[model samples]
Target: MELNSAKPGLLCSLEASQSQRTMYPYVTGTSVVALKYKDGILMAADMGGSYGSTLRYKSVERMKPIGKHCLIGASGEISDFQEVLRYLDELTLNDKMCDDGNSLGPKEIHSYLTRVMYNRRNKFDPLWNSLVLGGVKNGQTYLGMVTMIGVNFEDNHIATGFGNHLARPILRDEWREDLSFEDGVKLLEKCMRVLLYRDRSAVNKLQIANITEEGVTISQPYSLRTFWGFSAFINPTPGAQ
Candidate 1:
């Protein structure tokens, strides 16, 4: 028997096949916390990215520095957040080139990001993230949150994703506009501890960053337990309450 080959134009690929190959899954990040202190802003996020009941990551650093004085902490797709960081880095470098070698400041960075997020939202394909932008704007500490769809608002304290449910209440209760920098730090530390206990996505060892007029300072693997005077494993006496 002779075999015959099908003509190229006579056959078409299945639509379902194309769709299946092109479709990508969406991933959500767990929590991000941001608060404004007297001198600057403090932000932290959980290391975990959960899909359903599964833990995806445990050491992800969701916070990023946009320029010299501004910091951005995000909760959502890690890949998308990384792209935003890359774009911001390029934008900052370009701005510096036009400013006689002076790096872009917090306000300038925030304005640039507002336009970036809005532009993406107009295209109907946003970055799939919520962001906290903070630093000193106009000689005073400033803090704002931007949603995935580009809505931006300033707040004394803001928490997104899982942190919104687990950490925001604690933050709001303790937040004071007249709080000193030290008090602000202590409050944030307490907030992180609460999240670690209540928010499954949050971990005890986490990254913390402070943005101020002086610039951005990031602490690596800051120990929440050390600050709280407790170890990860608690030893209980037989009759302990």
Candidate 2:
């Protein structure tokens, strides 16, 4: 008897075919929180990346300064976010080469990212990230978000991943049109703290990027003050990360 040799060959062929078809995320980040403030825009994200359920890497930066008038924060596959950054670096480099005395602002960067993401989606090999973009252009605060499938929209405030679920409600209630830089930082920290408690992938350390007419200022990585002592934990507490 041949012992059904053809079945094994078929299974191996299917596995190989699937593996060659696309780039899948391995290590990924969790959420990004951002909003427009009185001066410009503030964006925040943690320095952690997860390998599946394991918190695999710390000190992974999820935010970057883009051009002169823009900052970008990402949640989802870490490598995919790096790839997107390379694309933007090229875009900005090309703009600088033109010497037209004009630079790509946040809105332009967001639109370009929309096209890149949509094009990748059509290829069925999307970048696997939800990105938050913010900046100040000629005193206008622009904040927008783009997803892996090319869906994009602008709002006064935005959050991705767990943040969309946990942090946006706080932003809606307390975010103000005249939010000073100090107040904005406090608000973002408050949001991140909530996520750290609820989100399994969230890390204690994070960064906040501030973009304004003057330029961009990304703060050094810092950890938030957290409280883990509560009577609720004795009975299997809520969000005990």
Tell me, by lDDT, which candidate is best: 2
lDDT of 1 at 160: 87
Q: How much is 103 displaced in model 2, in angstroms?
A: 1.0
The global C-alpha lDDT for each of the candidates, from Candidate 1 onward, is 0.74, 0.92
Clash number for every model?
A: 0, 0
What is the C-alpha lDDT profile of model 2 across 99-189, one tens digit per residue?
9999998899999999999999998989999999998998898999999999999999999998998999999999999999999999999
Prediction 2 global C-alpha lDDT: 0.92
* 1-241: candidate 1 lDDT, tens digit per residue: 1123644443333334444221232555667788887777888766666664567667778887776678888887777788789898788778777978576666666677777888887876677778888887558777887877778878889988767777788887888877777787788777777777666666666777888777888887766654434444465467543
Q: Can you give the TM-score per candidate against the true fold?
A: 0.77, 0.90
Model 1 / residue 54 / CA error / Å: 2.0
Candidate 1 lDDT trough over 10 residues, lowest sum? 16-25
Candidate 2: which pairs clash?
Answer: none
What lDDT score goes with residue 6 in model 2?
60
Global CA lDDT computed for model 1: 0.74
